[model samples]
Target: MGEVDIFKIMKEAEKRKKIKEKPILVKKVEIKEILPCLTTPGYIRFTAQADREIADVIPIIFLMFPPGKTNYSVKENTLTLRAFNRMITFFPNGKIAVTNTRDKQEAEEILQKIIDIINEAYRSYLKYGKPSKETIEAAAKLSWMDIYNSLPKTNCGECGYQTCSAFAVSLLQGETKLSKCKPLKGEYFKNLERLKQKIGEIMLNTLGWE
Candidate 1:
């Protein structure tokens, strides 16, 4: 019998379901303000508003990624993170501020991505119960530790990183590709397989990738 390609199976199932998925989205978003962002010097900030409040989904959406290099405030219902080389801040009242973007079109595109993510989280919340405070906190504790442990650990610079630890950090941040680590092709090939499953080839393929 031929072996089952689990990743392919899962991807197909998700694609089939995605066709029927209908998510409630903010009706309209208008960019009402444009301000200079000191962070990127020449770059600017895009301030926009959604049609409805997104307070409930803010925390749920934040769970989409690890807490590394991100800031969140429960009281204020806000999240700040990096994506598309821009700094994005999500507010509970459906306000969005994207910084470090020089063009209006790019800002609008980024806003759409954020809306897609928000809708994704809303769907998850509908299917599964809201994530607990404990679950959110635990996910934050997931640092470069597990990812670092899964590396070749040879401190090789072949991956354009000074050390394997650096490469692991980049991997967690989705800054670099898994194929960049050369040693994994050698005796540490097992590490490659392990990393693939850990990182979830199927999950990443289906998720809203930044």
Candidate 2:
């Protein structure tokens, strides 16, 4: 008879346990298109496709869209918004388009993060006939136009920008604050406050922070 080698057996069991507990990294995503950004210099656009069917998630995304930075069209079955400083569009065919990425590496990273959300939404839909509201709300964020429209439109240069649109873009980039808009008041201030809240919520939701 041979020795049992109990230590080796235990080590093997522990390795298997750790492997089982580790999350499975998604590998079924493919980057479909990579293009230069026409509107924004030094940025690129990436279009990606997931192997699994995600048509079921489009409507849930539309329903849970957060205010300000998000736009959803039920007729088109599409949702367009900003996330991680990139413009993203969720389509009905399990495909997504993200613009304004810094580079291919950054685009890939963003797609992975996006795929994580998609997987969560798909799983939720399969199990409960609905996607998680938190996931959808976290994924969608405000665009520059969304923020600009809510500003005073004074172009007062109090925010150190030649135009309110430029200031709105800066706010999205975290380069400035709403407080810098000295002339902002009344309804514009109220809108600005609400947009800020939404942006904060999205940051917390996506970054896994409280």
User: Which candidate comes out best when scored by TM-score?
Assistant: 1
Expressed as tens digits, the lDDT of each residue in 80-190 for candidate 2 is 866677678988776888888888898878887887666555554555565444434433545668778778887878778999999877665556666677665444667
Model 2 poorest ten-residue lDDT run: 201-210
User: Alpha carbon lDDT of residue 193, candidate 2?
Assistant: 58
- How much does candidate 1 score in TM-score? 0.62
lDDT of each: 0.70, 0.65
For model 2, name the residue pairs that clash. Answer: 69-142, 69-143
Per-residue lDDT over 57-148 for candidate 1, one digit per residue giving the tens place of the 0 to 100 score: 77776666544546777657699877677778888888888888877887888777877777877777776557666555544454677767
Q: In model 1, what lDDT does residue 137 have?
A: 52
